[model samples]
Target: MAAVAILLLVWQGVSVAGLVPRYMLPAPVEVLQAFWKDRGALWNNSLITLQEAGLGLVCGVSLGFLFALVMDASPLLYRAFYPILVITQTIPTVAIAPLLVLWFGYEMTPKVILIVLVTFFPVTVGLLDGFRSVDRDAVGLLRSMGASKKQIFWYLKAPSALPQFFSGLRIAAAYSVVGAVISEWLGGFGGLGVYMTRVKSAFAFEKMFAVIFLISAVSLLLMALVNGLERLAMPYRKVKQEEREDSQ
Candidate 1:
Protein backbone atom coordinates (compact mmCIF):
# COMPACT_ATOMS: atom_id res chain seq x y z
CA MET A 1 0.00 0.00 0.00
CA ALA A 2 2.81 2.36 0.85
CA ALA A 3 4.48 1.57 -2.45
CA VAL A 4 1.30 2.29 -4.33
CA ALA A 5 0.92 5.58 -2.49
CA ILE A 6 4.44 6.56 -3.38
CA LEU A 7 3.84 5.67 -7.01
CA LEU A 8 0.64 7.70 -7.04
CA LEU A 9 2.44 10.67 -5.53
CA VAL A 10 5.09 10.42 -8.20
CA TRP A 11 2.46 10.24 -10.87
CA GLN A 12 0.71 13.28 -9.46
CA GLY A 13 3.97 15.18 -9.36
CA VAL A 14 4.72 14.27 -12.93
CA SER A 15 1.32 15.37 -14.08
CA VAL A 16 1.49 18.63 -12.13
CA ALA A 17 4.95 19.41 -13.34
CA GLY A 18 3.84 18.91 -16.94
CA LEU A 19 6.39 16.17 -17.53
CA VAL A 20 3.81 14.72 -19.91
CA PRO A 21 0.79 16.14 -21.67
CA ARG A 22 -2.45 16.00 -19.67
CA TYR A 23 -4.13 14.40 -22.66
CA MET A 24 -1.61 11.59 -22.66
CA LEU A 25 -1.37 10.91 -18.90
CA PRO A 26 -4.12 12.50 -16.90
CA ALA A 27 -3.84 13.05 -13.16
CA PRO A 28 -5.15 10.33 -10.89
CA VAL A 29 -7.87 12.64 -9.67
CA GLU A 30 -8.95 13.23 -13.25
CA VAL A 31 -9.03 9.52 -13.83
CA LEU A 32 -11.11 9.09 -10.67
CA GLN A 33 -13.55 11.73 -11.84
CA ALA A 34 -13.85 10.03 -15.20
CA PHE A 35 -14.40 6.70 -13.52
CA TRP A 36 -17.18 8.14 -11.37
CA LYS A 37 -18.79 9.84 -14.35
CA ASP A 38 -18.97 6.62 -16.33
CA ARG A 39 -19.85 4.37 -13.42
CA GLY A 40 -23.11 3.14 -14.96
CA ALA A 41 -21.62 2.05 -18.27
CA LEU A 42 -18.55 0.71 -16.50
CA TRP A 43 -20.64 -1.35 -14.16
CA ASN A 44 -22.66 -2.93 -16.96
CA ASN A 45 -19.60 -3.71 -19.03
CA SER A 46 -17.82 -5.05 -15.99
CA LEU A 47 -20.58 -7.57 -15.39
CA ILE A 48 -20.30 -8.84 -18.96
CA THR A 49 -16.54 -9.21 -18.69
CA LEU A 50 -16.83 -10.90 -15.31
CA GLN A 51 -19.39 -13.40 -16.57
CA GLU A 52 -17.17 -14.35 -19.51
CA ALA A 53 -14.13 -14.67 -17.26
CA GLY A 54 -15.95 -16.75 -14.67
CA LEU A 55 -17.37 -19.15 -17.23
CA GLY A 56 -14.03 -19.56 -18.96
CA LEU A 57 -12.20 -20.13 -15.67
CA VAL A 58 -14.54 -22.91 -14.57
CA CYS A 59 -14.36 -24.71 -17.90
CA GLY A 60 -10.62 -24.21 -18.25
CA VAL A 61 -9.90 -25.53 -14.77
CA SER A 62 -12.09 -28.60 -15.29
CA LEU A 63 -10.53 -29.45 -18.64
CA GLY A 64 -7.02 -28.91 -17.31
CA PHE A 65 -7.64 -31.07 -14.25
CA LEU A 66 -9.05 -33.90 -16.40
CA PHE A 67 -6.11 -33.68 -18.78
CA ALA A 68 -3.61 -33.68 -15.93
CA LEU A 69 -5.23 -36.71 -14.36
CA VAL A 70 -5.25 -38.66 -17.60
CA MET A 71 -1.66 -37.72 -18.37
CA ASP A 72 -0.56 -38.61 -14.87
CA ALA A 73 -2.21 -41.99 -15.11
CA SER A 74 -0.49 -42.88 -18.40
CA PRO A 75 3.18 -42.12 -19.12
CA LEU A 76 2.76 -42.66 -22.84
CA LEU A 77 -0.13 -40.21 -22.99
CA TYR A 78 1.92 -37.67 -21.06
CA ARG A 79 4.81 -37.97 -23.48
CA ALA A 80 2.52 -37.64 -26.49
CA PHE A 81 0.24 -34.84 -25.34
CA TYR A 82 2.73 -32.73 -23.40
CA PRO A 83 4.39 -31.48 -26.59
CA ILE A 84 1.06 -30.79 -28.19
CA LEU A 85 0.05 -28.64 -25.19
CA VAL A 86 3.31 -26.76 -25.47
CA ILE A 87 2.65 -26.18 -29.15
CA THR A 88 -0.75 -24.78 -28.32
CA GLN A 89 0.80 -22.20 -26.04
CA THR A 90 3.03 -21.01 -28.85
CA ILE A 91 -0.03 -19.77 -30.75
CA PRO A 92 -0.38 -16.24 -29.45
CA THR A 93 -3.76 -15.11 -28.10
CA VAL A 94 -3.84 -12.00 -30.29
CA ALA A 95 -3.12 -14.03 -33.41
CA ILE A 96 -5.98 -16.47 -32.91
CA ALA A 97 -8.49 -14.02 -31.44
CA PRO A 98 -9.38 -12.55 -34.83
CA LEU A 99 -10.11 -15.94 -36.30
CA LEU A 100 -12.26 -16.83 -33.31
CA VAL A 101 -14.22 -13.61 -33.62
CA LEU A 102 -14.65 -14.20 -37.34
CA TRP A 103 -15.85 -17.74 -36.83
CA PHE A 104 -17.97 -17.20 -33.74
CA GLY A 105 -19.16 -13.70 -34.63
CA TYR A 106 -19.26 -10.99 -31.99
CA GLU A 107 -20.80 -13.25 -29.38
CA MET A 108 -19.60 -14.36 -25.92
CA THR A 109 -18.51 -17.73 -27.25
CA PRO A 110 -15.25 -16.56 -28.76
CA LYS A 111 -14.41 -14.52 -25.69
CA VAL A 112 -14.88 -17.52 -23.41
CA ILE A 113 -12.87 -19.75 -25.73
CA LEU A 114 -10.02 -17.21 -25.74
CA ILE A 115 -9.97 -17.14 -21.97
CA VAL A 116 -10.00 -20.93 -21.80
CA LEU A 117 -7.14 -21.17 -24.24
CA VAL A 118 -5.09 -18.67 -22.27
CA THR A 119 -5.85 -20.24 -18.88
CA PHE A 120 -5.68 -23.96 -19.64
CA PHE A 121 -1.92 -24.44 -19.97
CA PRO A 122 -0.84 -23.24 -16.54
CA VAL A 123 -3.36 -25.40 -14.72
CA THR A 124 -2.62 -28.56 -16.69
CA VAL A 125 1.14 -28.21 -16.29
CA GLY A 126 0.99 -27.22 -12.63
CA LEU A 127 -1.23 -30.15 -11.68
CA LEU A 128 0.81 -32.54 -13.76
CA ASP A 129 3.98 -31.47 -11.99
CA GLY A 130 2.26 -31.82 -8.65
CA PHE A 131 0.97 -35.29 -9.47
CA ARG A 132 4.41 -36.42 -10.62
CA SER A 133 6.04 -34.99 -7.48
CA VAL A 134 4.41 -37.58 -5.21
CA ASP A 135 6.90 -39.62 -3.20
CA ARG A 136 7.72 -42.99 -4.79
CA ASP A 137 8.19 -44.66 -1.40
CA ALA A 138 4.80 -43.46 -0.24
CA VAL A 139 3.13 -44.83 -3.36
CA GLY A 140 4.92 -48.17 -2.86
CA LEU A 141 3.82 -48.24 0.78
CA LEU A 142 0.22 -47.61 -0.21
CA ARG A 143 0.38 -50.35 -2.80
CA SER A 144 2.10 -52.78 -0.40
CA MET A 145 -0.78 -52.22 2.02
CA GLY A 146 -3.17 -53.27 -0.76
CA ALA A 147 -4.43 -49.81 -1.49
CA SER A 148 -6.43 -49.35 -4.71
CA LYS A 149 -5.34 -46.74 -7.26
CA LYS A 150 -8.37 -44.66 -6.32
CA GLN A 151 -7.45 -44.89 -2.65
CA ILE A 152 -3.88 -43.84 -3.34
CA PHE A 153 -5.07 -40.88 -5.41
CA TRP A 154 -7.52 -39.78 -2.77
CA TYR A 155 -5.29 -40.23 0.24
CA LEU A 156 -1.94 -39.21 -1.18
CA LYS A 157 -1.96 -37.64 -4.63
CA ALA A 158 -4.91 -35.26 -4.37
CA PRO A 159 -3.84 -33.66 -1.10
CA SER A 160 -0.23 -33.47 -2.23
CA ALA A 161 -1.15 -31.87 -5.54
CA LEU A 162 -3.57 -29.25 -4.16
CA PRO A 163 -0.92 -26.60 -3.58
CA GLN A 164 0.23 -26.87 -7.16
CA PHE A 165 -3.35 -26.81 -8.37
CA PHE A 166 -4.02 -23.61 -6.44
CA SER A 167 -0.81 -22.08 -7.69
CA GLY A 168 -1.96 -22.73 -11.22
CA LEU A 169 -5.41 -21.46 -10.36
CA ARG A 170 -3.97 -18.19 -9.11
CA ILE A 171 -2.34 -17.67 -12.50
CA ALA A 172 -5.45 -18.78 -14.37
CA ALA A 173 -7.61 -16.41 -12.37
CA ALA A 174 -5.46 -13.49 -13.47
CA TYR A 175 -5.37 -14.68 -17.07
CA SER A 176 -9.13 -15.16 -17.24
CA VAL A 177 -10.00 -11.46 -17.02
CA VAL A 178 -7.15 -10.40 -19.28
CA GLY A 179 -8.14 -12.94 -21.89
CA ALA A 180 -11.73 -11.73 -21.75
CA VAL A 181 -10.67 -8.15 -22.28
CA ILE A 182 -8.34 -9.02 -25.12
CA SER A 183 -11.06 -11.01 -26.82
CA GLU A 184 -13.47 -8.13 -26.32
CA TRP A 185 -11.00 -5.86 -28.09
CA LEU A 186 -11.54 -7.67 -31.36
CA GLY A 187 -15.32 -7.98 -31.22
CA GLY A 188 -17.86 -7.44 -28.45
CA PHE A 189 -21.12 -5.57 -28.06
CA GLY A 190 -20.25 -4.68 -24.47
CA GLY A 191 -17.29 -5.00 -22.06
CA LEU A 192 -14.50 -2.95 -20.57
CA GLY A 193 -12.55 -3.49 -23.76
CA VAL A 194 -15.42 -2.23 -25.86
CA TYR A 195 -15.73 0.85 -23.66
CA MET A 196 -12.01 1.41 -23.87
CA THR A 197 -12.14 1.27 -27.65
CA ARG A 198 -14.89 3.88 -27.73
CA VAL A 199 -13.03 6.19 -25.35
CA LYS A 200 -9.77 5.80 -27.22
CA SER A 201 -11.44 6.61 -30.52
CA ALA A 202 -12.76 9.80 -28.95
CA PHE A 203 -9.25 10.51 -27.51
CA ALA A 204 -10.61 10.32 -23.98
CA PHE A 205 -7.39 9.29 -22.28
CA GLU A 206 -8.74 9.89 -18.79
CA LYS A 207 -11.62 7.50 -19.37
CA MET A 208 -9.23 4.99 -20.90
CA PHE A 209 -7.07 5.28 -17.82
CA ALA A 210 -10.15 4.75 -15.69
CA VAL A 211 -11.10 1.52 -17.49
CA ILE A 212 -7.51 0.28 -17.37
CA PHE A 213 -7.40 0.77 -13.63
CA LEU A 214 -10.75 -0.95 -13.26
CA ILE A 215 -9.51 -3.89 -15.30
CA SER A 216 -6.50 -4.18 -13.00
CA ALA A 217 -8.68 -3.95 -9.91
CA VAL A 218 -10.93 -6.68 -11.31
CA SER A 219 -7.94 -8.94 -11.94
CA LEU A 220 -6.64 -8.38 -8.42
CA LEU A 221 -10.07 -9.11 -6.97
CA LEU A 222 -10.23 -12.41 -8.84
CA MET A 223 -6.76 -13.40 -7.69
CA ALA A 224 -7.69 -12.55 -4.11
CA LEU A 225 -10.80 -14.69 -4.41
CA VAL A 226 -8.63 -17.56 -5.59
CA ASN A 227 -6.36 -17.04 -2.59
CA GLY A 228 -9.37 -17.17 -0.29
CA LEU A 229 -10.54 -20.38 -1.91
CA GLU A 230 -7.05 -21.83 -1.55
CA ARG A 231 -7.09 -21.11 2.17
CA LEU A 232 -10.48 -22.78 2.59
CA ALA A 233 -9.41 -25.79 0.51
CA MET A 234 -6.10 -26.21 2.33
CA PRO A 235 -6.86 -25.76 6.00
CA TYR A 236 -3.72 -27.75 6.84
CA ARG A 237 -1.63 -24.81 5.63
CA LYS A 238 -3.20 -22.70 8.34
CA VAL A 239 -2.43 -25.38 10.91
CA LYS A 240 1.16 -25.51 9.74
CA GLN A 241 1.42 -21.75 10.10
CA GLU A 242 0.01 -21.86 13.60
CA GLU A 243 2.47 -24.62 14.56
CA ARG A 244 5.37 -22.56 13.28
CA GLU A 245 4.22 -19.53 15.27
CA ASP A 246 3.90 -21.69 18.39
CA SER A 247 7.41 -23.06 17.84
CA GLN A 248 8.75 -19.54 17.63
Candidate 2:
Protein backbone atom coordinates (compact mmCIF):
# COMPACT_ATOMS: atom_id res chain seq x y z
CA MET A 1 0.00 0.00 0.00
CA ALA A 2 2.80 2.41 0.84
CA ALA A 3 4.54 1.67 -2.44
CA VAL A 4 1.32 2.15 -4.35
CA ALA A 5 0.73 5.45 -2.61
CA ILE A 6 4.20 6.65 -3.45
CA LEU A 7 3.84 5.62 -7.08
CA LEU A 8 0.46 7.34 -7.31
CA LEU A 9 1.94 10.53 -5.86
CA VAL A 10 4.77 10.46 -8.39
CA TRP A 11 2.39 9.71 -11.23
CA GLN A 12 0.00 12.51 -10.26
CA GLY A 13 2.92 14.92 -9.88
CA VAL A 14 4.25 14.02 -13.29
CA SER A 15 0.83 14.46 -14.84
CA VAL A 16 0.34 17.85 -13.21
CA ALA A 17 3.85 19.02 -14.07
CA GLY A 18 3.45 17.93 -17.70
CA LEU A 19 7.00 16.60 -17.65
CA VAL A 20 6.28 14.44 -20.68
CA PRO A 21 3.25 14.30 -22.93
CA ARG A 22 0.20 12.57 -21.38
CA TYR A 23 0.00 10.08 -24.27
CA MET A 24 3.54 8.94 -23.60
CA LEU A 25 3.01 8.29 -19.87
CA PRO A 26 -0.49 8.37 -18.58
CA ALA A 27 -1.42 9.16 -14.97
CA PRO A 28 -2.19 6.32 -12.58
CA VAL A 29 -5.85 7.37 -12.44
CA GLU A 30 -6.02 7.35 -16.23
CA VAL A 31 -4.44 3.88 -16.30
CA LEU A 32 -6.90 2.68 -13.68
CA GLN A 33 -9.82 4.01 -15.74
CA ALA A 34 -8.50 2.34 -18.87
CA PHE A 35 -8.08 -0.90 -16.91
CA TRP A 36 -11.71 -0.76 -15.85
CA LYS A 37 -12.88 0.04 -19.39
CA ASP A 38 -10.96 -2.90 -20.84
CA ARG A 39 -11.50 -5.22 -17.89
CA GLY A 40 -13.35 -7.95 -19.82
CA ALA A 41 -10.87 -8.20 -22.68
CA LEU A 42 -7.93 -7.87 -20.31
CA TRP A 43 -9.33 -10.54 -18.02
CA ASN A 44 -9.85 -12.99 -20.87
CA ASN A 45 -6.36 -12.47 -22.26
CA SER A 46 -4.83 -12.66 -18.80
CA LEU A 47 -6.59 -15.97 -18.15
CA ILE A 48 -5.14 -17.42 -21.36
CA THR A 49 -1.66 -16.28 -20.40
CA LEU A 50 -2.14 -17.60 -16.85
CA GLN A 51 -3.11 -21.04 -18.17
CA GLU A 52 -0.01 -21.18 -20.36
CA ALA A 53 2.23 -19.99 -17.53
CA GLY A 54 0.74 -22.38 -14.98
CA LEU A 55 1.02 -25.42 -17.25
CA GLY A 56 4.53 -24.49 -18.31
CA LEU A 57 5.61 -24.02 -14.69
CA VAL A 58 4.23 -27.43 -13.79
CA CYS A 59 5.93 -29.16 -16.73
CA GLY A 60 9.23 -27.38 -16.25
CA VAL A 61 9.39 -27.96 -12.49
CA SER A 62 8.44 -31.63 -12.81
CA LEU A 63 11.07 -32.29 -15.50
CA GLY A 64 13.68 -30.29 -13.64
CA PHE A 65 13.06 -32.19 -10.38
CA LEU A 66 13.24 -35.53 -12.16
CA PHE A 67 16.45 -34.56 -13.94
CA ALA A 68 17.94 -33.30 -10.71
CA LEU A 69 17.04 -36.59 -9.01
CA VAL A 70 18.69 -38.59 -11.77
CA MET A 71 21.79 -36.43 -11.67
CA ASP A 72 21.95 -36.69 -7.89
CA ALA A 73 21.73 -40.48 -8.10
CA SER A 74 24.49 -40.74 -10.71
CA PRO A 75 27.73 -38.76 -10.49
CA LEU A 76 28.54 -39.62 -14.13
CA LEU A 77 25.26 -38.18 -15.34
CA TYR A 78 25.86 -34.96 -13.40
CA ARG A 79 29.39 -34.66 -14.80
CA ALA A 80 28.11 -35.22 -18.35
CA PHE A 81 25.08 -32.93 -18.24
CA TYR A 82 25.89 -30.07 -15.86
CA PRO A 83 28.06 -28.22 -18.37
CA ILE A 84 25.49 -28.73 -21.11
CA LEU A 85 22.79 -27.23 -18.88
CA VAL A 86 25.04 -24.24 -18.18
CA ILE A 87 25.65 -23.76 -21.89
CA THR A 88 21.96 -23.87 -22.68
CA GLN A 89 21.29 -20.87 -20.40
CA THR A 90 24.17 -18.89 -21.95
CA ILE A 91 22.13 -18.45 -25.16
CA PRO A 92 19.78 -15.51 -24.89
CA THR A 93 16.08 -16.34 -24.97
CA VAL A 94 15.38 -13.20 -27.03
CA ALA A 95 17.54 -14.71 -29.77
CA ILE A 96 15.70 -18.01 -29.47
CA ALA A 97 12.16 -16.56 -29.29
CA PRO A 98 12.03 -15.77 -33.02
CA LEU A 99 13.28 -19.24 -33.90
CA LEU A 100 10.75 -20.81 -31.54
CA VAL A 101 8.00 -18.80 -33.23
CA LEU A 102 9.26 -19.78 -36.64
CA TRP A 103 9.33 -23.44 -35.72
CA PHE A 104 6.20 -23.69 -33.58
CA GLY A 105 4.08 -20.91 -35.09
CA TYR A 106 2.09 -18.37 -33.00
CA GLU A 107 0.35 -20.99 -30.88
CA MET A 108 0.03 -21.66 -27.14
CA THR A 109 2.34 -24.62 -27.68
CA PRO A 110 5.25 -22.33 -28.49
CA LYS A 111 4.53 -20.01 -25.58
CA VAL A 112 4.28 -22.91 -23.16
CA ILE A 113 7.49 -24.39 -24.52
CA LEU A 114 9.28 -21.08 -24.13
CA ILE A 115 8.06 -20.78 -20.56
CA VAL A 116 9.27 -24.32 -19.85
CA LEU A 117 12.68 -23.56 -21.32
CA VAL A 118 12.98 -20.37 -19.33
CA THR A 119 11.83 -21.92 -16.05
CA PHE A 120 13.60 -25.30 -16.18
CA PHE A 121 17.22 -24.28 -15.71
CA PRO A 122 16.74 -22.48 -12.40
CA VAL A 123 14.78 -25.38 -10.94
CA THR A 124 17.29 -28.00 -12.09
CA VAL A 125 20.32 -26.15 -10.75
CA GLY A 126 18.63 -25.22 -7.50
CA LEU A 127 17.32 -28.69 -6.77
CA LEU A 128 20.59 -30.34 -7.79
CA ASP A 129 22.56 -28.11 -5.46
CA GLY A 130 20.07 -28.77 -2.68
CA PHE A 131 20.21 -32.51 -3.18
CA ARG A 132 24.01 -32.58 -3.22
CA SER A 133 24.29 -30.28 -0.21
CA VAL A 134 22.51 -32.81 2.01
CA ASP A 135 24.32 -33.76 5.21
CA ARG A 136 26.70 -36.61 4.38
CA ASP A 137 26.67 -37.86 7.98
CA ALA A 138 22.90 -38.30 7.87
CA VAL A 139 23.21 -40.40 4.70
CA GLY A 140 26.01 -42.43 6.25
CA LEU A 141 23.89 -43.10 9.34
CA LEU A 142 20.92 -44.12 7.20
CA ARG A 143 23.12 -46.41 5.13
CA SER A 144 24.47 -48.06 8.32
CA MET A 145 20.86 -48.93 9.12
CA GLY A 146 20.65 -50.76 5.78
CA ALA A 147 18.62 -48.02 4.08
CA SER A 148 18.56 -48.49 0.32
CA LYS A 149 19.39 -45.64 -2.11
CA LYS A 150 15.73 -45.00 -2.76
CA GLN A 151 14.96 -44.99 0.94
CA ILE A 152 17.83 -42.59 1.67
CA PHE A 153 16.68 -40.23 -1.06
CA TRP A 154 13.09 -40.34 0.13
CA TYR A 155 13.75 -40.11 3.86
CA LEU A 156 16.78 -37.82 3.91
CA LYS A 157 17.89 -36.12 0.66
CA ALA A 158 14.49 -34.88 -0.48
CA PRO A 159 13.56 -33.43 2.91
CA SER A 160 16.89 -31.64 3.19
CA ALA A 161 16.45 -30.21 -0.32
CA LEU A 162 13.05 -28.62 0.22
CA PRO A 163 14.44 -25.21 1.15
CA GLN A 164 16.57 -24.95 -1.96
CA PHE A 165 13.78 -26.33 -4.11
CA PHE A 166 11.49 -23.59 -2.83
CA SER A 167 14.18 -21.02 -3.50
CA GLY A 168 14.36 -22.15 -7.11
CA LEU A 169 10.58 -22.30 -7.27
CA ARG A 170 10.36 -18.62 -6.31
CA ILE A 171 12.81 -17.70 -9.06
CA ALA A 172 11.09 -19.94 -11.64
CA ALA A 173 7.66 -18.53 -10.78
CA ALA A 174 8.89 -15.03 -11.65
CA TYR A 175 10.43 -16.24 -14.90
CA SER A 176 7.36 -18.21 -15.97
CA VAL A 177 5.22 -15.09 -16.53
CA VAL A 178 8.08 -13.26 -18.17
CA GLY A 179 8.69 -16.20 -20.49
CA ALA A 180 5.02 -16.33 -21.45
CA VAL A 181 4.99 -12.60 -22.14
CA ILE A 182 8.15 -12.68 -24.22
CA SER A 183 6.89 -15.63 -26.28
CA GLU A 184 3.58 -13.86 -26.76
CA TRP A 185 5.44 -10.74 -27.84
CA LEU A 186 7.17 -12.75 -30.56
CA GLY A 187 3.92 -14.38 -31.68
CA GLY A 188 0.66 -15.26 -29.94
CA PHE A 189 -3.14 -15.19 -30.26
CA GLY A 190 -4.06 -13.75 -26.84
CA GLY A 191 -2.01 -12.69 -23.79
CA LEU A 192 -0.57 -9.64 -22.11
CA GLY A 193 2.17 -9.59 -24.71
CA VAL A 194 -0.33 -9.45 -27.57
CA TYR A 195 -2.41 -6.93 -25.68
CA MET A 196 0.68 -4.81 -25.12
CA THR A 197 1.53 -4.92 -28.81
CA ARG A 198 -1.99 -3.85 -29.71
CA VAL A 199 -2.00 -1.00 -27.20
CA LYS A 200 1.41 0.18 -28.35
CA SER A 201 0.31 0.11 -31.97
CA ALA A 202 -2.80 2.13 -31.10
CA PHE A 203 -0.68 4.49 -28.93
CA ALA A 204 -2.89 3.71 -25.93
CA PHE A 205 -0.27 4.32 -23.27
CA GLU A 206 -2.74 4.15 -20.38
CA LYS A 207 -4.02 0.75 -21.39
CA MET A 208 -0.48 -0.50 -21.82
CA PHE A 209 0.41 0.67 -18.33
CA ALA A 210 -2.70 -1.08 -17.03
CA VAL A 211 -1.66 -4.34 -18.67
CA ILE A 212 1.85 -3.97 -17.27
CA PHE A 213 0.41 -3.45 -13.82
CA LEU A 214 -1.72 -6.56 -14.20
CA ILE A 215 1.29 -8.61 -15.22
CA SER A 216 3.23 -7.50 -12.13
CA ALA A 217 0.23 -8.33 -9.97
CA VAL A 218 0.02 -11.80 -11.47
CA SER A 219 3.71 -12.46 -10.92
CA LEU A 220 3.50 -11.25 -7.33
CA LEU A 221 0.49 -13.45 -6.68
CA LEU A 222 2.36 -16.46 -8.01
CA MET A 223 5.37 -15.81 -5.79
CA ALA A 224 3.09 -15.46 -2.76
CA LEU A 225 1.37 -18.73 -3.62
CA VAL A 226 4.75 -20.49 -3.87
CA ASN A 227 5.78 -19.08 -0.50
CA GLY A 228 2.54 -20.38 1.00
CA LEU A 229 3.21 -23.81 -0.43
CA GLU A 230 6.73 -23.76 0.95
CA ARG A 231 5.44 -22.95 4.41
CA LEU A 232 2.91 -25.77 4.18
CA ALA A 233 5.52 -28.24 2.93
CA MET A 234 8.00 -27.39 5.70
CA PRO A 235 5.90 -26.40 8.66
CA TYR A 236 8.33 -28.06 11.09
CA ARG A 237 11.15 -25.82 9.84
CA LYS A 238 9.25 -22.86 11.20
CA VAL A 239 8.93 -24.37 14.68
CA LYS A 240 12.05 -22.90 16.16
CA GLN A 241 13.34 -22.98 19.79
CA GLU A 242 11.34 -19.84 20.60
CA GLU A 243 8.16 -21.52 19.46
CA ARG A 244 9.01 -24.62 21.47
CA GLU A 245 9.66 -22.54 24.58
CA ASP A 246 6.39 -20.66 24.14
CA SER A 247 4.50 -23.91 23.71
CA GLN A 248 6.12 -25.38 26.84
Best by TM-score: 1
By summed lDDT, which 10 consecutive residues of candidate 2 come out lowest? Answer: 235-244
Model 1, 9-52: lDDT tens per residue?
A: 99999999999999999999899999999999999999999999
Candidate 2 residue-wise lDDT, 107-128, digit = tens: 8888888888888888998899
List the candidate 2 regions with Cα displacement exceeding 4 Å: 241-248
Q: State the displacement of the C-alpha of residue 101, model 1, in Å, after optimal TM-score superposition.
A: 0.7
**lDDT of every model, 2 decimals:** 0.94, 0.91
- TM-scores of all models? 0.97, 0.95
Candidate 2 lDDT for residue 74: 88
**CA deviation > 4 Å runs, candidate 1:** 246-248
> TM-score for model 1?
0.97
Pairs with backbone N, CA or C atoms under 3 Å apart (clashes), candidate 1: none
lDDT, candidate 2, at 55: 96
